[model samples]
Target: MTPAQRRRAAEQAARRLARTSLFRRARHLALYLSHGSELDTGPLLRCCHAAGKAVYVPRVLDGQRLRFERLVEDMPMQRNRYGIREPALRGARRGAARMDLVLLPLSAFDTQGHRLGAGGGYYDRAFAARRSGGPRLVGYAYALQQAAALPAEPWDVRLDAVVTEKSLHVFRN
Candidate 1:
């Protein structure tokens, strides 16, 4: 999709997300910064800020794990090994389990909540120990990214829901 198209779709998806009870109840949210043709997260970030929600973005650590740091205005930022920009490790960070909601980026997804990331296992490893009532894992992507089905591994972390420009698909209670 073109830049303008992607922006418009992202805005629509963000509006859908904002209307969800999950988004309304969340106090601390972990969101990814938009990169490449992935769905833009600018609209969601603005919505979160407007609603007085604390927003965090992931920072890659040791090229393996993800550390979520609060996203503050004018905070320092550096690109990870994959060229994804992340908040610099300066202030207190929150673990995945501590967040109320986590919006993950994906390359593809299915109704079963399986997500295909950028071939990196950072998110999976970070949430590997997630238990019941833990942070809700949500995938943020475009509707076109949905596939009929995708293979899953035993260690794969399933998403609780996936929000696309078209709609929101919930897979778990």
Candidate 2:
């Protein structure tokens, strides 16, 4: 499916999950702000802030890694090479707080719970290095991004759960 179709599906899926009692229970959430061709998360972010959950957004850094930065409505934003909106950062943000939940954007996912990123390996590598007791990984995607299977490499990390517009899928591993 095209990226647009995938995004629409994922956004609808995330909206459904956001309205669920389970997701509403989270007090602190780590949510990625969407960039070009990714699932739209504007509504989700607004819903989270309005619900009084502390929202944490990712800032891409030099190491092909991510650092969690507290997202405030007043923060300045700029477009990266990929045309995704991101907050400007003076330095690399630090530490992983105890997040009650996390929402991850994906280019693709498989029934086996593997994620296919956009080839940068940023999310894969960061997730591998994250040792703090924060939110569990939950991939957010449109149902169209679902694949029958994905090739998992040694460094590729799996998700604890995946939520598509059609359903919320949890993995046991």
Candidate 3:
């Protein structure tokens, strides 16, 4: 889709997210910086900032796990081995368990909220800690990325919901 179209779609999805009770109650949100043509999260980040929410972004570690750091205003970041920008860890780290909401990036998804990631296990490893329930995991993707079906493994953590440009798909637990 065109840049204009993508922006408009992202805005629509962000609006839907804003209307959710979860977002309203969430004080800490985990978000990722959009890489390439992925649905731009710029709008969502702004909304979270305006709502007085503290946002955290994951920093990939050597152990194939993620260490989330609080995203401060104008936070300086450094790129990881994979070229993904991560917030520089200047102090003690915070994990995903502390977040109230997690907006995850997905390469593709199905109606069941099965997400296809970048083939890395960082998210899966970190998400394991959330199985007992902590933050609400939501896959952020464009409507075009949805597949009719996708294979899911025992280790592949399914999302609680997925927000697309057109609609929000909430999976049954």
Q: Which candidate is the best by TM-score?
A: 1
Question: Candidate 3 regions off by >4 Å?
Answer: 89-92
lDDT string, candidate 3, 128-167, tens digits? 8575568899998888999999999999888999988788
Cα distance off (Å), candidate 2, residue 159: 0.8
Can you rank all candidates by TM-score, best first? 1, 3, 2
Write candidate 1's Cα lDDT for 1-173 as tens digits: 88788989999999999999999999999999988878999999999999999999998878787889899877888887788888766666888999999999999999799999989898999899999989999999999999999999999999999999999999963
**On residues 14-49, what C-alpha lDDT tens digit does candidate 2 reach at each position?**
678787765788876778877766667876787787
* Model 2, residue 89: C-alpha shift (Å): 4.2
Question: Which regions of candidate 1 deviate over 4 angstroms?
Answer: none
What's model 3's lDDT at 128? 81
> How close is every model to the real structure, measured as TM-score?
0.96, 0.83, 0.94
Give each model's whole-structure lDDT.
0.92, 0.75, 0.85
Best-first order by lDDT: 1, 3, 2
Number of clashes recorded per candidate: 0, 2, 0
Instruction: Using TM-score as the measure, name the better of candidate 1 and candidate 3.
Output: 1
User: TM-score of model 2 relative to the true fold?
Assistant: 0.83
Instruction: Compute the lDDT of residue 9 as modeled in candidate 2.
Output: 73
